[model samples]
Target chain A: MTTSIHTLDTPVAVVDVARMNRNIQRMQQRADSLGVRLRPHVKTTKCAQVVEAQIQAGAQGVTVSTLKEAQAFFTQGVTDILYAVAMAPNKLAHALDLRRAGCALIIVTDSVAGARAIVEFGRAHDERFEVFIEIDSDHHRSGVRSDDPLLGDIAKMIHEGGAVLKGVMTHAGESYKLNTLEALQEIAELERSECVKAAEAIRAAGIPCPEVSVGSTPTALSAVHLEGVTELRAGVYVFFDLVMHNVGVCALDDLALSVLTTVIGHQPDKGWIITDSGWMAMSRDRGTQAQQCDFGYGLVCDSNGTLIDGLLLRSANQEHGVASFEEGMSVDVEKLYPIGTQLRVLPNHACATGAQYPAYEALQPNGEMAHWSRVNGW
Target chain B: MTTSIHTLDTPVAVVDVARMNRNIQRMQQRADSLGVRLRPHVKTTKCAQVVEAQIQAGAQGVTVSTLKEAQAFFTQGVTDILYAVAMAPNKLAHALDLRRAGCALIIVTDSVAGARAIVEFGRAHDERFEVFIEIDSDHHRSGVRSDDPLLGDIAKMIHEGGAVLKGVMTHAGESYKLNTLEALQEIAELERSECVKAAEAIRAAGIPCPEVSVGSTPTALSAVHLEGVTELRAGVYVFFDLVMHNVGVCALDDLALSVLTTVIGHQPDKGWIITDSGWMAMSRDRGTQAQQCDFGYGLVCDSNGTLIDGLLLRSANQEHGVASFEEGMSVDVEKLYPIGTQLRVLPNHACATGAQYPAYEALQPNGEMAHWSRVNGW
Candidate 1:
């Protein structure tokens, strides 16, 4: 007999397949409507089945955060992979290995020194690498400024040093802080424009810059247009979380990932329902903490995926999540959620939560469950 | 030619073997002097090699937060195991399986309902399972109050139903908030006396309560005496982190764990030296945020493991960490920390950071490295 989600062990990662498919379709349609290639970042799920589904639903290529991800995806027959993070000289050999093994692996750099290292490594190995110069959009994190002269110099370093200057890419990660569509649209425009400007500067400097990629979950869903962008990339949309919910990108029902936990005990005087799933299962990502509605840990839901009103996973230890009622709703917690009672918790950030588990219990609409293995660690 | 710490891939967990050995010896000596058995919680570093060292250093039994840890340690010949987390009835079968395999797996429960389920499951399986009654020493997390009448009833339920009533246990997890020796000792004594009171209550009810266990990293180190406590348990002391440092327990040099990362790029305008280790590598555990000094994500250290004064990992994305000067200290960003420069980051919480990697590169005193595989996922 096949095991259902209810039969699986507690503190396990569960993926609602129906909701996941709907989310996948929504983002694919959004990217299609915006007229750009959708290269979903596999760093979010890192699951072969999920990536295969995205590819089947029209994701052009995959974006990875590590060489391990690139190697894993490449081994799974995915040839087009972009190692999104700036290439450290130490990892050049590993990236070269993936490329030599017939994978179209692209590397990224935002500094002249980084570009020089990639070029020197490629020259030493007799391999010309496809490289992308990262542009700093909204000053969120890594990347060269769009108007900075370093951008053209880095682009030239790659092209002139016998490496392919593939394009310019930037993630509007700051968009995660916005709660309104107007703000998200404004940042999305900024991300697209800045990245495109960098690409144009590279071209003006006699380097061939083909692609302009930009996205983040909120921006990918809220952007009015993608004028100069060639590809849209987003990760958390596949498993929309409470952070995305508070960001006005998706509703609570759109969340596909939840930690399946069992109520192991209770703290009656404090109105706490202690759960088996804690930071170890849901992750320590308080991504929703600074958002409009801070979900302390996560939003509580019933075993069948129904939201439990006023219930929240307030605090967590390593293996124990202390869930309690929000402020004044004082019901007999033990009578309501007793020992052995199974509950589901919607995570604040899907990518972080997913990384905690080795596999996902994909709950199908027909009550069947499939085990989907995820690639964790660097 | 042996592999050195510098040769390991970026964003890898590195364990200073010498520091770890010193930590192990210190905790073992503390337990010895306090006249209590040391049951070091293997949840901090779930590596068999680390656990082996702890056992060799005089730790009697292992304390685990998950049944997976028990199974793993048991497979490695550690039969004396205490599954410290409150027992969930759904996991009774797994516990039974371990017992049937000749493993002395001790389980815990804090409620009558939980006791009844454990006894019933044991009766059905023809096994008298050893159990410990969890006591709420400081209103920290899960447990029955020490003076609560329900405690005796739960202990009596297990004894009357033909299950082995092992003893009483408590963890003064709130001790983590204490920075002064007096505060730590007070909480530690409170933990000891309260857990002993619960054991006395159980015995007063005619149930042979044998064991009295209590601990926390801070309490374990600061307790002048463990008076009525038979055994002590602590986890993070094995690989002390920034939170423990801020709590005034371990010195900066006592930190046995650090995430070895490479400087990938830089945001010179913001004086941010970007590294490959982010929340994904160091974990989103801002455990030190509420402590004496908030070490943003972690304290920055040089490649040789010496603290770099005033430099901190200020913010983190999924795969990128922004390391910047704390306040007044300023240096030429590009000139000081160039691309490809390796840096070691001390995590805010060792348990959380250690969980991010599947294996650790143990840095030997002789400048060699050994791979220690960690068991992750429940």
Candidate 2:
């Protein structure tokens, strides 16, 4: 007997399982065609079942943004984990603990101070830590410029200071801002070439640097070739969102994650239908606002996961969302959607929206349902 | 013996217990002077310890935004609970269950359909649910206007249909948009008079209205008197944030919640000091963006909680924050905040930031520390 999603609580996270599996298979196929290993970033879902599904689809290892994610996935028996964010000195002991627990945990460093701290911690703990030097291809966030002299210095520090210099990795996060395939491909190539150059720079310094990693959801889907990159990493493609759709990467129906909310009341004068899901359920992610179309918190959908064009969740309080037409008055809102009317909202960013819920109610193609719990706080 | 906050994991929520207690006492005292019961909204910090502290400081009851919060706090012995959001029909069973369990759970409704659902559900289940008629004082979100004809109909529907019409409640949520004391006072008065007017209308319809409730953090602290209001409700005051600071309701030092983060690297060329606390940690609130002084994501502070002027967390990725001066170049960025330099970030909105964490590392003024866990998902 399959449980029905209609009977579950409102303001709950709902994942279309068949769509999620299709997304997983597509990313794996893309990586395979590009001649690179796929290391899916688990930060988006952080669910063991989702990660297992990716692994089953031929994804090797995993990328995490937090030590807690690393620890959680490691406890679930997926040993190959890469802590992708630049390593902080304070987290060295936690990394050491994970490494000692027989997990192949690889850490990243980008600055001289970071490399020194990792090396010092490794020496003090009598452990050789595997390290990757983060490369700045897009100048989006953390990382060292590929051609900067500090690149060689940081690489040498990790190599000479009793740590294994695994290689270089870069994420073209700025690719999310681009809507055209040409721009995405350009950023993807820059990401690949810059990261490969950094690896070569370290090799020229007499250190055997293996592995070149590069990707972001946009770049991964748009890259013409992987070339020197040994592996590709991407998050959010596991459950596409409105931002991805606006960026021209995914179709609207491909959005696998949505918040299932129930209309609680209405303001006929204002043409507003209030829903139980607000910023607390949808998350305060306005990622699509900068795109061509601004879906004010999210795009509204009918109860059966079909898009209801022209309506948007225009505003939100902690527990109340106001849904209305994008342009004019939504006449007959009360009669159209009365109290207890269930609706779905596609998020602007899956990673942010998925973080709000403790577990997602996965709806299978055959109408079966399953609960998938995710990692919460660090 | 006490543990230093520095020893805790990076990106952990830190609550100043002394400041929180003072905030609680101040609100309770204000309610006492106003001749009203204080029903502190527990949505900002869903921690039982914080609620217990508020109750000890003379708060009469607690207000929650979600039923899960109601359930969690009810399990902790909080009997008089108000689920503040407008009631959805699908949740009637859960509300009935809570009422049957000897808990004084008060639900809210603002429309005829909402009232009809509650009345029908109560009659079907052989339960007489206590309910509040929600009044829209500021047109901020959900509620019926005091002069709206629907207000009387909704109240009559609940009272005449085998359910208890407890009273009327309203929230002056737009008070947060005002920075001047005069405007805040004006909104506060409007909140009180409108809610009381709605209650009087209900009484005119032969229903015995016993209570009138109103408040918001800015309005609660700025109101000279809350006449005709039986209780005041305000969230985000217990752990005042940057938005409240800009709203002129709380001093910066009165902010009790902060995210403790560590400098992982730096972009010296861009004068960016990278920290581990990103949007995922501090939340994508940006509540102060439209305020007088826009704190990008948040205001930067020293590890000891001293505000570092001119610096703001300008941008954030999923797991990396870029902190820099608001205007000119921040020379010696690496020297000023080297790798591993711990810093605290005051959040833009306490309710949003607190929702991102599972537990808070509460620090006592006497150097003692405790872990306070909070409710996460609905």
Q: Candidate 2, residues A1-378: lDDT per residue as tens digits?
A: 377989989899999999999999999999999999999999999999999999999999999999999999999999999999998888889999999999999999998889999999899999999999999999898889988999989988999998999989999989999999999889999999999999998898899899999989999999999898999999899999999998888999899999999999988888899999899999999998889999999999998999987889998888999999866644788998899999999999999999998999999889988999999888
Clashing pairs in 2: none
The CA lDDT of each predicted structure is 0.92, 0.92
Q: Which residue segments of model 1 deviate by more than 4 Å? A: none
True contacts kept of each: 0.87, 0.87
Query: Candidate 2, residues B1-378: lDDT per residue as tens digits?
Result: 488887988898999999999999999989999999999999999999999999999998899988889999999999999999999988888888888888899999999999999999899999999999999999888899999888888888998999999989999889989999999889988998899888888888889999898989999998888778899998889999999999998999999999999999899888899999999999989889889988888888999999988888988988999999866654688998898999999999999999999999999889787999989888
Candidate 2 has a TM-score of 0.99
Residue-level error in angstroms, candidate 1, position B114: 0.4
lDDT tens digits, residues B277-307, model 1? Answer: 9899999999989887999999999999988
Instruction: Write down the C-alpha DockQ for each prediction.
Output: 0.89, 0.89
The best candidate by lDDT is: 1
Location of the lowest summed lDDT over 10 successive residues in candidate 2 chain A: A325-334
